[model samples]
Target chain A: MKLDSRKLKILQAIINDYIMTAEPVGSRTVAKKYNLGISSATVRNEMSDLEEMGFLEQPHTSAGRIPSDKAYRLYVDKLMQVRSLSEQEAEYIKDLYESKIMQLEQVILNTAKVLSEMTNYTSIALAPQLSMVTIKHIQLVPVDKSLALLVVVTSSGILKDTLIHIPEGIDSDYLYKVSNILNAKFRGKTFAQIDIRDLSDIRNELAENQKFFNSLVDVLTTSFREAENREIYLGGTTNIFNFPEYQDIIRARSFLNLMEEKDLLYNILVNSRNGGVKVSIGTENPYEELRGCSIVTATYSLGDRVLGTIGVIGPTRMEYSRAVSIMDHMGKALSRYLTKLYGEQP
Target chain B: MKLDSRKLKILQAIINDYIMTAEPVGSRTVAKKYNLGISSATVRNEMSDLEEMGFLEQPHTSAGRIPSDKAYRLYVDKLMQVRSLSEQEAEYIKDLYESKIMQLEQVILNTAKVLSEMTNYTSIALAPQLSMVTIKHIQLVPVDKSLALLVVVTSSGILKDTLIHIPEGIDSDYLYKVSNILNAKFRGKTFAQIDIRDLSDIRNELAENQKFFNSLVDVLTTSFREAENREIYLGGTTNIFNFPEYQDIIRARSFLNLMEEKDLLYNILVNSRNGGVKVSIGTENPYEELRGCSIVTATYSLGDRVLGTIGVIGPTRMEYSRAVSIMDHMGKALSRYLTKLYGEQP
Candidate 1:
């Protein structure tokens, strides 16, 4: 009746075997494959108890039972060992930083790719939400007679460039004067910090150039609004084909579609931004598309500031111990690189 | 043995049936469905001749025949009708620009996505090679104590931002000095135009500052070399799942991996830069992975200057008429947007 040590041990064995083969585990197979010091009959009886306890499920077609998400959750939390990455693996994550004089975008993109290659799972690197980061500089470069490029550099190392159309009166000297005023006013203010009052202040200073002022506001407002949608770089999208779970073409297609839904992943990553690795297993996942999958996410931070996430997605029967360990290690590696890249004194 | 109108009609009917059903075409079905006027016996004889000519391939496991890439090419060039887009479709492409005060990157990306959705094939938008684009402006923003963000705006509406680390003894005032000198030399000149002479000229002007100069050279060289590898935006990768050709996981994985190889795409696009619309059929493709595929590409241009490519990839039994139509429309739409955004007198 109780989840005693022996029953828990049996549960662990079934989950482990299932994770390896992605097949329903029978008591006899577990008894033969694992030295659980139990007879087949005993193992079968314990599996029945585990099923009664809602730790396993028997599909309509298969006689053998598979460990439920509940079982995997318990395994990830208590049964499994969180093994730290070895010398070479840790070195690989660390080496990602030195291997290139990378921008923040490059680091996140490469790390996402390497994470997938190493773990053989779908990976995502969520780009940091940077609207709150102080503006470092803003420049306007004339591209054509009436078009210009507005380049914005943020202290968090995010750069955004938008195309702006100049009005009739805006000339080279006028552009320079406006840029100087923009630099003076926007140099250290975040987009969140700039408001209607700031717009009015700039408008009054250049009250005569109302058309150009409207264009500038439109560009700034658009960029800030766009910053709300955090871009996600996905890697090893095809790696899902390696898993038996994706053997069904329909299931594989749906999973691929899920990878394209950025809002779903953004929410999952955002909610977990408070700290270290968080594992959402199977039915524990909020999105219907992920109900059959498990997501392992680790937050990458700079000091107390949460930048983004490094994570992987695999079938519910995942290598939990290894995924968690690698995520934890890589999370630290990304944090270290970000600190070196954007954490220096401004 | 002589080529005739009836034989071509029968081939067209077979190809159309195969494309619609993604199944091997039998002569009886083609005759019945297409109302080809020929008897099943006559259609069968024509199909055999088509197979002998390498216009069709008979699978070892099936009695039916499928169109070969050569057949698709003949169909595209000689048989297929390059119908203009429906008013709604053309309107949809045009609406993409007005709906958002979009940047070039956004326009290219959305066009790739829409091209795939409309044609039900994988699509690509090759980012413009900007090394030859004339520099319009340059600005450097100090980030951390040592880190700075370098923003470069080009006349072709491309903005590149790179991170540079400042060495000791270089103040913000010194950066302003260096930026002014950089603007003088880099403005109105393409990266190709700024040779060793320009580098030494800058060096002579900033001879007092050597360490910072070295950092600048490293960043510039990296950016220029990186530009050579054209960034390709791919869409509807999972759309391959809709086709019977990718039903085999191995073939599907190889095709997906091919999509990841930017160099392969870069070469294909570059070679097509001198043309309007190009159709490379099956064995005609250079990459082995593309041997079973058909790629239809249309070049987008600004005036006589080639900007980039818009293309689609599908099975050898592709909807050539439709894919070709959508690509040509989107390419021109993109070209029109580019010209309006950047084509004004400088």
Candidate 2:
């Protein structure tokens, strides 16, 4: 919907006031509080026009007006001013990025915690998927008489290990030899590109060591299948309770319950994956339980491939402009940090 | 407070009705629905006394009564009857336990999902801690020219991996030699029992190889430190919304927010570490934000050491007796699973 400058100002004032107080905004209240150089009657007339255009709503005949979904859309798209991060917030982000995290899980968790703490909203960050990156190296180590450890390291620096059972009497020297051969052949190849049909030929070429080669291929296939699974991280879910909008105990419980569903959350974040920042306002989310909340999400990437998304969730009347900016900046910082960690310097 | 048989029956009826309907129970309705052999007037008189004893509460003068915190306690301790799991539920749990999981994370996630689906309540399961378990074996494999991978397999069959950086030109043969020496020295000891003072002596023995030894120790420390961090899995969070009690969006969101707090959840689960089932009714939980809900928790163990907790969360009027029984059974099952995996099979 088109919004003229005067009407835009009125809508912005209503939204800003409503967000702060969580109370309806009357024409008189907006006119007096904002000093908009207009009388209450004129402001009321403008509000009526805004309502007709689906930008405002009134709860009852005597109540003041509030911003509608359309109004929030307009404000987010056109009128809302992106606020710069406070000095403390910028320092927090910088410190987080500078910290030496030992694993990708720690990095994702700390990022979510920092974002949620800064925004005073629930935050979610998904770890970079292993499938997007090629396997850099594979190592097999004999753990016991009958078991060997399969360690796989990806180009993105994620380390995954699994235990595979080898028949008794297999010497560590033979295991090492097989590991070397597999690493030489499979290094730098993505799991998707590995051909299962080639295993028989590879095993036949192992001379008298065909048994060990068959076991090695089986272990590698299992590891790749397991690696395709995704890991997700969430932080600061407790921040949701502090919002006035969730004062009711039942509503608070429902939202918390929804967060526990991994499948639902994975779908929510993955499906909303547009390249840049995307805001899903109240009722815009797919789940009915989240109809009263808004999600501000941004997809972060390592190079051109999207790694994962970072998002903040709050009441529908949330500070959309600030949330959008925070997510956008954090997304870029995370992307750059990930790229650096993966040795993709440009 | 002590309750006579009639009062006990009345309390049980009220709790059962409230759990099923999530609405206040009136004396007349109880008299009509239950074959208590009592008139509505008599039931009302008993309910009034129950309220005076803090076992029930009336929202208003003319409204029906709801179970109070005192009432839930009585029901949990004495009145409520524990029911056996339905055939479907038993089969579901069996199927879940029988499935071949890809990793420890999958096992925990699937366990949480099974509990939540069976109970129709939110479930949280914490991962077993690795530090308490002794290392079965350790293996080091060369990943690239500058990096190596360490795979540590615990006695309980859990696999943890860490990336170790090797100084520029270290060869695979040198790494293999170091791995053998380190394993001989540190294989059976838990990380907490490792002596740093003696580690320095070992480093001195390495001399020209000191850098690699130091790097290996760094990798080991990082692996154990990461494993010590609690991993929580949550399921059926959205089920909270389906309850009539959480019809108000505000209340649902507040409780949902509380569940999202990692520290809060850790504290809640760990504080009740009596190695048995624990029921914390309304206002009994340490956090005020969780005052309106009830948490039923039980700690699972590998032999004598408490590894983690598994619990269900619901409203104060929840089916306490059944929840406690389920938790108790699940705790034993998990402990047995761990014992079997660790070679302590019965």
Candidate 3:
């Protein structure tokens, strides 16, 4: 039951064939189609032994064999060679970044779309978590006497704005004084660090505009709460139905339902421990609904901090080497871009 | 081919049956299912007359008839009685808005999701255009000596923020002073109004900090340029596969490709001028790629201003009456919520 070199070759051929055609690979077809320099009988014997060792699976008694989840894991981990992205694909990624000076949110959105369009699989990108980032500045703009817009900027260049209602007769000058005093006292502090104790002195200084000032402080301190609700950007969700495996309504429904749960997707990306390409084959995915699919995720980092993850979801017979390599490249590219954009934190 | 009640009855039955089952409706089947109290021969005669009048089409000589685009138009215009939403469905929309104090962007997002999930069709929502909105307030929050966050509050409560680098040693006080001057001069003005002359006086006032002050003004005036890029929120794009019409990959690809073109979608939403349920059936849709689809859009308003659109894309055989009714109700609900949130612009 040992996986010899010949056995590994047979397994790779089966997986590659299944990924391309979505059909089970028989030894006869492999012998004819692949330059394995082996006899059909020999390939059949290896496939049977591989199945016995759990690397291949036969759907029916007389049918061809397909690679099992264990086989995919083995291939992804050791046997498969990382396919270099085509020059055009690399150029496409480069051009995407260069085409416009996109905000970080737009950049992440475009990355998800490019991945899905290139791989023809559903792509998911988790927006970078902002809770750990410190608050760099808070600005309020006057819309009118009765309302002001609150803008929060993080040190990492993330910007969030919310609208807050103010009491009537609070003039523009009053808002400016409050903004100046608050920034002087509370700048550079994280949301977790700010509380009533830190704001009491500033609150007293703005006693003339006490109600509006208190509301502004409340809005600023709780500002992180809004950004903490990380958005999950999904692209090409319907690409799953293109696969024969998901053509069945029952299977398709499960995947559609699973993709709708943003929290579950976030958890999947968060559960990956390292900032490297990680491939979870079918049955290895923690969620029951996702057991029929395979997911490959690569976490992108900014400086030392891993900010978010980008992933591709496809049928178990996915183009693992290609998806992995593309994801790996994208992750690095995103990390490079983010680092360049925000590395000078001052 | 004079207009008659019998022909209308037969056309309605055919459309209703085809919409529900996606199967062509034979005269015999329609008569039996609809309890029209007509003989098969009489029903068949009426169907033939309706087909001659361009209300129905037969896929094959022997097969049952399906409603044509012309038929759908007639049905939507006159025959189809708007289906009332189920209590559960009504409660879902009510609960969505009540659950959180969502900003307009979030509200549009949730609306897209609710439409797609409820109707099982792809939903699209465009964020309100910012050009028409007047500048209400601006706030500056200091992140550091070399960076500050710019916050723009539009008169309509749309909050936008951006990060700009500043000269080293520029303190929070300088930003507050600049913000106060900008608000004092530019309050209640549009992005169209802010120019160098308006800021020249303020610029001279802050001449000691010329470089930093100029950049602040440049960032503030140019800030609306970014917000002007309208965002298209899409949900349930894959739900197209649930219909038999898009089972072919070519048809599905066309729809997917069409959805990816945000400009095209924005144009489609924008061209619908009036504020009510609008249905574009099949070839009536302006874009070639969308000719196979039907779009049901409802425009949501903020006070008297028509903000943006919310829509559903489905196969031509879509449940028009139901989709229209839901869209109409949701649009009003969104408008009401937005008005309540940002109505008083005093």
Candidate 4:
């Protein structure tokens, strides 16, 4: 119960073995496989003590011991050693980022792909939150005699466009002039500010075309208001099949179904509520469906402004040290790239 | 060994029963379940003839018959009945379309969701090809000190926006003026035209900001050039597990992997070539991994202008009649919506 260094070593041996083979670890196997300078009898006594302390459990009377969620929690929090990525893996990540990616959405998507491929687990990335970002410009373009396009740009380098119906007789030249007037008036305002600010001047300028001008402003306001809706990018979801725990069809279906629900995934990542790498082991996860899984999350940010979260989901016996290290590095890299993109701090 | 009338009826009963139950259909089962008014011996004789004609096969000597790819082809082309959807299913689709959806992307994504849910198979929708559509409008929005957003609207109701870095000291007013001038020159022009047209007039207009102007035009050109890059929307991929054929983990993984490859899916949809509901059953498919699968595709179009494709992928035992009917209906619905959107006939 005291969990002295000897007992701790026995627990570490059990967890490490279980993680590798996904099989229970017996004292005799631990004694034979590990150079712990201990006899099988001594290892057995220490294993009994660890089990009594609730860090390990036996599946059956004749079986070896498996690590309980408690043991994994302890390992992740205290006993685990972070391993550096292999030279090949580091080079792979380097090559992935070296490609000329022009958009932040692509960056986030590629991050999900690389993480899922490297870790061999499902990866989810939440796109940056854009609500507080200010609008830099708005443009209206004529599509035909009956419809036009509305385009909005935000300070943090996000682009959104929407189509709107326009009244007839609005020629391309006339729409161009209106686009200029609107952009000059609305530039550098946040969506929140635009929502509250008066655009009477522009409204009066286009008063003769009141119906078209009003609809244009309404569409722009709605686009800005809806900017915070985050897009969830998921990768390698079927890798769930490779894990023995999910080989059962029912369990696999539940896990796969959970990945498809974007709102639930977004909530899971957002609720981590941690600024740095945080490991949620087994039942520590908030959702009942995910209680059988382990989630490792890290927030990406620019200065103190948190952009979003990136996470990896795997069986409870995940490669935590490796996943945590990768996430930590990725968080920093994403933040650096975004900061460079915005050309600012915070 | 030609399939006579009785033999065709027997083959249809076996294939129908096998599709529904995923069990081998014997002569007795068909005689009892289908009320074919023939003795088991007579039914068995006809089944033997069908088998010799390459329309049925036996998995084992003691087992009954299952339809081969050849038989499914004949049945799809001739024998299958077009069953009307249930009232609840019709209502579900009507409700989905009745929602206040505005964007074409959202419509396609929602269509994928509804199709997968209704058919209980994985669905993929390829967005309309952008290259053939003329540029209807162009707007430039300011993002920040160093960034800007370019919004393009095409005649076919498609909107694409991109972010670009900007030089220091350019104002929103100037960008507006430049946007107006560009619209005067380039509006109603196709990307194909822009690619070939000389831009000396606009180049001279922004001669002081020639570097910025040239790069801006270059980015716009690149965006237009890459317009044909199709966007694939996938839904209900986990439904792959529902079919007995893909219950094998390896088979399911391969199917899921194929969906992740966008280019391959684009090719599959494009190579389908036909403008109506097309069913490729089992080994009839071109891709080796999908040889065990069936894909039902239908192209949605307005007049002579083909927009893109919508398809459902499932095991060879898929309910082809229902999927084909659904695709045919949904294809027409999509074409109607897109035509109303672009407000023109091809």
Candidate 5:
């Protein structure tokens, strides 16, 4: 349905008021608050037209109107004004970036906490993924007669290690030789690029030292596959209960159940995989359980490769323009940090 | 509040029936269902006394009785039936143990999931503490011209690694020498045992290599203090919503807020630090927000030293007997697995 300028202004006023007050908007409320330069009767007529176009809904004939999901989509896409962060909010973001986060996990976790505190909504951040990183080095250290430790360092400065048990009688000298061979063969390659052919070649080279070679390969495979343990840090999950819509216990429980599933969270962030900021409003998400929620997500990258996602979650009635701006700023800040830390530019 | 066997049996029956049905237990219903070898009138008289003693409450003056916090405490302490796992439950536990949980984080995460599934309640597991684990070995591997990786292997087979920057002009040969000295001095000692005094002595021992020695000590000390990142895993948090008490969104939100705080969970587990199973009934928790819930926890150990905790969360009307038995079985199984993995018995 086509909307004229007058109708558009009326719709925008209703959406903005509804977003702020979480109450249905009436012609009188909009006329009094927004000064749209129209009579209440004329404004009411335009609202009725907007409702017919599916941009608004009235709980009852006597009550005011609320923005339908359609209205929210339009507002987010074209009408809403993207607001700059207040001086205080800007300082909070600056403080987060300046604070010394000891590890990548700490960075993501603290980011989520800060977002939730600033916006009063739940926040989630996925740790930087190992697949986006290349193997920089590998080392094996003997722990006991039967156990050895395998350590792998990625180019992005991420460190991971695991313990492997070598067969009895395996000497430290032989272990060191095997470590060097594996490192020489696999260095600078991403895990996804390393294949069975490479494994077979390593095996063939160490044919004379079969047991030690097999154990070393097992340790390397396990260490690289350890990326599956990449965790999603969730902050302010309890904020869901603060919303009036979730005042029903059953609704709150369903939302909590959805949040607990890692796969669900992964899917929610997957749309941001293309290395850009994305906002998914209520009902825009494919999952029915998330129909009442909105997600504002951005991908953090090291150079051109997207590492992972950072996002905030809240009720569909959340401030979309502000959330979008915050996420956009965070993505840029994160990219800059990664470039400095890893000596690469996106 | 002394009670004879007959009065105790009636109270027990009331609690058991109310827990299963989530209904106020009438004397007639308990007398008919439990076959307590007593008439309805006799049961009613005992219930009246139990109420007077603060063990039971009535929704209305004429309604049947429900177990109060004191009643649940009494049941958990002295009346709940402790039973062994069924064959199916035992098989589930065995499967969890047999699965190859490669990382300590995975082990804790999966354990919480399995515990929640088995008991149909919220489950929490704290990760193993590093302060108690002795360093078995340390390796420093050159990652690039500018960086080196620090790998530390603990006695329990957990490997942790951190990336350290190599100072300008430091060669691999000097790094190897420093690594050797670190291995000689720090191996077999906990991070807590290493001090600035020890670093000064080592610095004097290295003489001309003071820069390398100081940098190495800084890296090691930083890695040790980073042990504070140990996480607590929470699973099935939504299960609380299934309880009738949490039907109110306010109550559910309050509970979720309490659970989301890491310090709150850590404190809850640490309070049960005594080397045995613990049952904290409603109002027993030190936190006011958790007063409506009952926490059943057990501290698992590595030999004589307490390592971490495993527990379940449910409403006060929860099945105490089942939760306690499940926690007990898991605690023992986890201890056995860790002992086998570490090659030591607790």
Candidate 6:
């Protein structure tokens, strides 16, 4: 099983064909469709060799052979030529940035829409990971006797504001004083680098307002964790129907049910967080609902910080070359738009 | 054929059985099961009359009869006694609000989840209408040379903060001064009540910074319009697979596709906004994708201000009595939680 060049070519052709038609690729079909200067006999011999080497499988005893996930992983890593996006798709991405300055959420959402529309697969865009973003400002504004507002602005212009309890009553001057102290400690530091355990000295300084101080720390900690478990925006969820594998009620049900569970999707996207486009095929995905699927993801950043991931999900027979190319370009486009949006590198 | 008690009872029995079994009802089966004190012969004759009156139809002449959308509408309007939610369902809702204070978005999302889980049907919850909520506080915080944060707090504790352009160099004191004037005009007024058309006199004072003022007003107007077109949360989208009608690929595709469309769902929910529970059945729906579905909605409010609608959508053979009761209670529970979250009666 040395995987000679002729055998590799046959395996590649079978995978490319299966990705298109979702059917097993027979030697005759491949030989007739692709001019590889080989007869059906030679193609059939190579196909058998490829199957023996674990790159192909016969779904039925007498049917044509389909490429395995191992084959796709091979193609994605080496053999496949990543095609550039069509003019229309590039325009959609260009227009999203050009149409006007969009909020960060809208920019991520539009990226999901473009990816899904361009490659008829379920697309996901995770929000920027605020834990990785440096805190630029912190303010505590007194709202009323029982509630106060905690506003934290990040370096890339992302804001997190929540109504926190002020059970001890609001001392406007005191709250502003605490906010100033917090600003001094937290500015230019990522939440991941800052910890409650490291701030015992500051805690002792606010011993009289311990309850309010605890609430303040809780809000910041919660925001940091929430960013780690950020929102997953999905587009073309129903596009799962386009594949023959998901036409079955049982299969579609499992996939759609998986969509309802955010923790699982969060983990899936988070695991795909490499600096560049990464492809996870079939059993490579740990989630059972995705055992029959493949995922292609790329990290999209804000400013110089890698924010989160954006991906395309489809049946294991995915158009990996195109999906990777699109994701790579989309991730770059979003980074540029976000950096430009926040006044060019903040 | 003027409807009589016996005919109405038979039609009700048929629709009830169809809702549970998703099968057409036969007169013999109805008489045997319902024990309606009528013979099969009597029930059969009444069924014929009901079909003639357009309350029931047969897919094939040889098969049993099924209830029409008109029959379900009638049942929803006059015949069905809205049963109270089960003890378990009541506890689920009570626990949601009682557990902890939740953000408004989370409150709406959890409501949809509980509704869908209780009824085993796809559920929808529209976000609270900010246009109906009066403004409580407004602030403009200067971020940098080119950006400012616009923070608007609604009376109901909803916060909308967006980054707006500061085209002119930041004069921190001037922005604060202008903010005071804007607050004097906007406080205690709903976005719907406050319009750019009424603020021309104030525009004169801001004529020197016309571009900045225009950006400020544009942000407000967009926020107002966006609140009118707020997010619609969905739960149990795969619940469509539970119905036999959506088992077919074409039917399920259309239903799931409709799930992705927020504007159509927005219109559907908005049209369903009455003072109480409203049921739109089958052909009564305007959207073609929903022709075979029924939507039951109830208006949930914050204090006395009507916020938005929460709804359940399923095949036309909807469990009307249970869904109506659940929605009625769920809407009230949400209203109570929201009012309480905003510190009550504000």
The top-ranked prediction according to DockQ is 5
| Highest-scoring model, lDDT | 6
List per-prediction Cα lDDT, in the order shown: 0.82, 0.78, 0.81, 0.81, 0.80, 0.83
The C-alpha stretches of model 3 lying farther than 4 A from their native spots are A29-37, A83-89, A98-102, A117-120, A169-227, A238-253, A344-346, B30-37, B82-93, B99-102, B117-120, B169-186, B191-228, B241-253
Given candidate 4, what's the lDDT at residue A225? Answer: 69
Candidate 5, residue B244: the lDDT equals 78
Scored against the native two-chain complex, candidate 2 gets a DockQ of 0.40
Residue runs of model 4 more than 4 Å from their true location after superposition: A168-221, B169-186, B192-210, B217-221
True contacts kept of each: 0.61, 0.61, 0.39, 0.76, 0.79, 0.39
lDDT tens digits by residue: candidate 6, B1-346: 7999889888888988998999888989999999999899999999999989999999998889999888988998888888888899899889878866447788888889878988899999888887888887777776667777888877778888888887756676777777778788888898888877756765887788888878887887788677674689998888888888888988888888888788999998877776788888889989887888899899988878788999999988888899889888988888877877784432
Q: Please write out the lDDT profile of model 1 over residues A42-152, one tens digit for every residue.
A: 998898999999999998545889999999989998999898888888888778878865567888899999999889999987887675467787767555567776777
- Please, what are the lDDT tens digits per residue for candidate 3 over residues B192-237? 6666578788878888877877677666666646545468888997
| Candidate 2: tens digits of C-alpha lDDT, residues A60-176 | 989998888777887898889898887887788889999876577778889998989889999987677667677787677776777777777877777767667677688878777
In model 1, residue pairs whose N, Cα or C atoms come closer than 3 Å (at least 3 residues apart or on different chains), thus clashing, are none
What is candidate 3's lDDT per residue for A160-190, written digit by digit as tens? Answer: 6767778988876776777677677656775
lDDT of 4 by residue, A254-323 (tens): 8988998888898988776468888999888888888879999888875567778899999999988899
lDDT per residue (tens digit) for residues A164-241 in model 6: 888755587787788778888888888787777756766877887788778877877777676664688998888898
Q: How do the residues B1-346 of candidate 1 rate in per-residue lDDT, one tens digit apiece?
A: 7658888898898888888998889988988988978789989898889888888888864679988877787888899888888998888887876666456677788888888888889998788767646778786756557777687777666778888888866676777677888888788887667665677877887777787888898888787777654889999998998888788877887888899888898888888887688888888988787888889999887666777888999888787887788888788878887777676364
Second chain of candidate 4: TM-score? 0.92
**Worst lDDT window (10 residues) for model 4 chain A?**
A337-346
